[model samples]
Target: MTWPVVHISRSLDHDVAAVSSVAGNPANLPAWAAGLSSGIRQEDGRWITDSPMGVVEVAFTGPVELGILDHDVTVPDGSVVRNSFRVVANDQGTEAIFTLFRRDGMSEADFQSDADAVRSDLDRLAVLLDKCLLRTR
Candidate 1:
């Protein structure tokens, strides 16, 4: 069965390429993605991190481009979550969009909380990008 999807977006005052460069790299996840801020390490070609739930693995399977940042995250329970992230050009800056899918058996409250976390992460990303822009100027 197809699950529900929640989309959260934030506009960053930075170039699309710049945003994509940082967001597309899994190494930068700890800096922007609060959910994975505990830490991320690589083992046997897989990215691993510790979450409140437990140890999880993340794999970024998207092409490196200006607007694509897809990845699969394996939770501690062994459930895989697919995230479709994008960084698109907008006016003089860029807009980052993150797609979250409601997994099976997830309650409405849980889904809402997950969406809020995504929004917070996107906001943090914008702040990081803004700092990068300032440093380059």
Candidate 2:
């Protein structure tokens, strides 16, 4: 499977305590994530949202439980593309990687567009972190 990745990282001027607090809070998903309006409650403890692209749901499955947000988009010819948003924290800071993929043949133009969209979304994340996650203290 071919998956294109777009990654972004920034170090907040605050300590890990503040950064971790925001990273660990699932309720703040929509605050930063583009296309995501609100996170709905589900039975399995995953946050759900009706994103700009489609209906997306995120779950924490790993030790850090980096929330996974995914939704599928359909092309006119009945092909499907999967879009995913992943958020994780490291010594540097919180990192977000968005990927786009297709099961069948997909054009390079489509892939580039998809990657650009993800990059724009991450751009919003940078603003969100500055405003909501990291505050002057």
| TM-scores of the models, in the order given | 0.89, 0.54
Candidate 1 C-alpha lDDT tens digits along 1-137: 78889778898888778888888777889988998898899899889998888889988776757478888889977888778988888998888888888988999999999999999899888788777668887
Model 2 bad stretches (over 4 Å): 1-24, 42-44, 51-56, 65-103
- RMSD of every prediction: 1.6, 5.4
Q: Which ten residues in a row have the lowest lDDT in candidate 2?
A: 60-69
Best by lDDT: 1
lDDT (tens digit, per residue) of candidate 2 on 1-137: 55444443443443344544554455765665555545545546646556555555564433334344444434334455455545555555555555555334667887677567656656665676678744554
Q: What is the C-alpha lDDT of each candidate?
A: 0.85, 0.53
Give the Cα-based TM-score of candidate 1 against the true structure: 0.89
Off by over 4 Å in 1: none
The residue pairs that clash in candidate 2, if any, are none
